[model samples]
Target: MYRTWMRFLTPGPAHHRLGLVCLGVGLQHGALPTVGPRTLDHHVAVVISAGTGWYATPDGRRTPVTAPALLWLTPGVPHHYAPDPETGWDEAFVDFTGPATAPYTELGYIEPDRPVVPLTEAAAPRGVVARIARAARRDNPLLEVETAAAVHELLVTLRRARADLAPDGDPVLKALAHDACTPMTVADHAAKHGMTPAELRTAVRRGAGCSPKDYLLGIRLGRAKELLATTELPVAAVARRVGYDDPAYFSRLFTRRTGMPPVRFRAQQARAVPGGYGDRVPDPDDPPMIAGPRRP
Candidate 1:
């Protein structure tokens, strides 16, 4: 029987906290020998660079995975897994321990159960691999910090993908997501997607398990909050982008949805980012961006 490996990441003095793994293909060519049953002090992620691997969990559950698969391993989760030794896996991942970790968890990216989760098919994780390569090139303090920040990003990417893939999705849900930042009407979306409004509502209920309006509102609210907090755009502009017309009405809707006015929302978002981490992430308070100006 092939022996399972549990390769744990060793953080240098320059490294602290993580959510990403940025290593080169050099140390990643060989089969990971220390993956199965190894202790995870922080969190170790496996980002496949150029090989096939099998990710298995405790209790004998296993699945074959390949490059492009993002493996999220939380700290303290004792699990046995490894790569397909023949081809061997090339990847880098970290336990991602930091203040932002909890917020990531709250966003439903990392789960308490299984560690690995796949990201959206539309986006490429090549940047993560590049970041890892950059880190592997050196062990300097700056590199260490960069690796940690990169891991956090990898987590965020997966979180965004999770939002995209709704478990119990339906036609209306899909339609609403089709253009979250644009001025879209549910009736138009329903017609475009080939269903009557009522039928769309029913499908949404059965497939996504949420009301169409609620689902759309949730997505819009998330976008609105992001824009209000991250961008220098005026509140009126942010509201306009998110489907509201009048700024006063927008403020009311924003308050109702987020329980705080747009201005306050922006302040809270600023306070939430980790010190020195602001430059890394897009302004969380920035508005939802679209290709066009507000609808007529």
Candidate 2:
């Protein structure tokens, strides 16, 4: 006989504004009946952890669903599926929806076009689902907020677990981020990697959901901010360290992006140190222990 446990939630409007909210969660196993040939109004991440199944898209093409796979059922999408009648499948699912989903989709964290996704492992995402299920208690006052926060974690975990992605991330994206502080044009960076500028653009867009130039600038400006706030370096020194040779140009760029000049931003964001600022972190609360003489 099949066994199933599930909880459906109705979070208030205020929780919806928190950017992501959980609608439901479930865990099931054994010979389950067929699901849908129907449509849903929200999204469901059905994680198949064991056994096998078959899924059909709106176009009527069916794909096999093996263990360690995910089925992304998005809003207004027609979906149909079922486990093998004899073996059945172990499945856990999380239903979620929010404005945050749009950006998550754009950033490649969610794939609507490809409904069935192979995962390298199902344990991590399943753990997140279990947490959501635990938080689904009827009388938990913090249930809505706790489960909603876990939804965000669940999405990120699923993205990282995709079978297509490398364990460390895309090689090209990793290399680009590694060299982000170098003073090189996108074309120069592309040439170094043996790619054309157009190809580099496509890779960055696919991996990061942004142009290559924007990606490098984000990294460079972030370093510039850190140097300005933590060190007593002059603006020009900060600029040079972050790859901009022309101080005037760096100032303008930084101000345009950060809405203030470097000095002003530093003034506002600088950390307060009990002792004078230095490379070593301040340990005001926990002083280093002194050694006592050893007993003879």
Candidate 2 per-residue C-alpha lDDT over 18-52 given as tens digits, one digit per residue, 9 for 90 to 100: 99999999999998999989998888999999999
Query: In model 2, which regions exceed 4 Å deviation?
Result: 272-296
Q: What Cα-based lDDT does every candidate model obtain? A: 0.61, 0.91
In model 2, pairs of residues that clash are none
For residue 96, give model 2's deviation from the true position in Å.
0.9
TM-score for candidate 2, please give it. Answer: 0.90
